[model samples]
Target: MRPKITFFDTKPYDKEIYKPLAEKMGFDVRFVFYHLTEDNILLAQDADVVVIFVNDILNEKVINKLHSYGVKLIALRCAGFNNVDIKAAKDKIKVVRVPAYSPSAIAEHTVALMLSLNRKIHRAYFRTRDANFSLNGLMGYNLNGKTAGVIGTGKIGKSLIKILKGFEMDVLAYDPFPDNKLAESLGYQYTDLDTLFQKSDVISLNCPLTRETKWLIDKDAIDMMKEGVMIINTGRGKLIKTTDLIEGLKAGKVSAAGLDVYEEENEFFFEDLSDQVLEDDVLARLLTFNNVIVTSHQAFFTKEAFMNIANTTLNNIKDFCEGKELKNEVKI
Candidate 1:
């Protein structure tokens, strides 16, 4: 019999792609839009496997509950698995992830956010729609001569560096295990976090979310940044401090912000909350800024990325059920 898999936090698009993919892979997929919580842990009671997303809470309690019900594996569709308590799942509930579904899909969207924020394209389009063609406060700086700081030089970061280089921007990257061969070929300079922050005209975050990376861009880090800097985050949200970013934006220390993720995104993103009054104060304030561009964490929402995610998720489940060694198991 095919293993029963409970999929949590599924959107319509996710359902559209994964339903067919799961069928093709012969998975007994049970869809649940509810986030994984103590109350909903029973939802996976009958399933042999559980598939989760970023917003789902899979803590010790949840894992133990699932284990009690004889769940064997936890498969993650996204690259980052910070949401899952890997230590708790270790030895008991096996964990795996789709490490690289489509790096370029996210990389291209990172550049898209950077462009839209820097050039005020979203604002310009809205103004033009209303027939207001004035150039007041719409000036944008050229990217050609600017320096771009890349936090992580992984697949997505490497892809982003190539795009920035195409615009002739000097690239500075920081990674504990820097890919010297890739940097040598791509002409990217490796630098410390302080130097990258102080000199970069544009900074893009492409790193994973871990204990070391949480709140990487805090108040003091922002203080070290050059004034009028543009910051973009296409990676994990908690990497940036929401309040600190807001403070920087207000002080003109940060010229613009293009975020595809948010620190308090659990309550707001992946759903339409336009009609309701937003209870999240920081997100509400971000909407008021013309220089800030928030895109509902859609950096990985492209067709190519979705397809790759679907395939990888199905394969992860397949590999686990087949008693094969899980490929992308997290150390912690």
Candidate 2:
């Protein structure tokens, strides 16, 4: 019998992509519209593998429930694994993820957010739609001589650095495990967080969400930054404290912000909330700012990234079924 796989938190696009991929891989697949939750854990009772996305909550209870149901593997389609409790699933189930489906997809989106925020493209487009061709308050600074501070020098960060360098911007990066060789070749410097914040004209968050990195851009950090600095985030949401960011924006310490993710985004993103009033006060307040640009988490929504996620997830399932070493498995 082919291995049985149940995919949760599935959207129409997910089914459109994964169904054919599963057929090619010769696996029995089930797609669940509802996300994996305590109440829906039973849905995967007969499956050999469970596939999930970032929004699924796989805590200790969920892991234990899956173990009881004979589910052997947990495959994540996205890179960030903060949503999963690796320690709880350590001995009970194997967890694997697509660590790098398309770094360029996210990197390019990061740059797009920066450019749009800097040039006031969103405001310009709206004004033109209203038959107002005036260029008032649309002035943007040149990136040619500005310094860009990048947090995290991983694949995505490195890719963004290359783009920033192309614009002749001086780049400063910070990573616990800095790749000095790469820095030397790319013409960027690795510096401490304080120095980066104090000197950079624009700061981009591209790091993972860890205990140390949670709320990395807090009030104190914001106070250290240059006045009228531009802030961009394409990484995990909690990497920045939403309340602190709002304070910075209100005080004019941060001139503008381009955010692709929100700390509480799991509640609003990937769904249509237009018909409903936003109950989240913080998010509603963010929309009121003309200098802020917020996009639903879509940095990795490109066709290339989606295809790579589908292929890698199927391959991960295949490897497990064949008793091969799970190279992408997360170690607790």
Best by the TM-score measure: 2
Candidate 1 stretches with Cα past 4 Å from truth are none
Q: Please provide, for model 1 over 170-220, each residue's C-alpha lDDT reduced to its tens digit, 9 standing for 90 to 100.
A: 999999999999999999999999999999999999999888999999899
- Which ranges of candidate 2 are over 4 A from the true structure? none
Models, CA RMSD each: 1.1, 0.8
TM-score of model 1 vs. true structure: 0.98
* Error at 178, model 1, angstroms: 0.6
Rate residue 118 of model 1 by lDDT. Answer: 78
- lDDT measured at residue 137 in model 1 versus the true structure, 0 to 100: 78
Q: How many pairs of residues in model 1 come into backbone collision?
A: 0
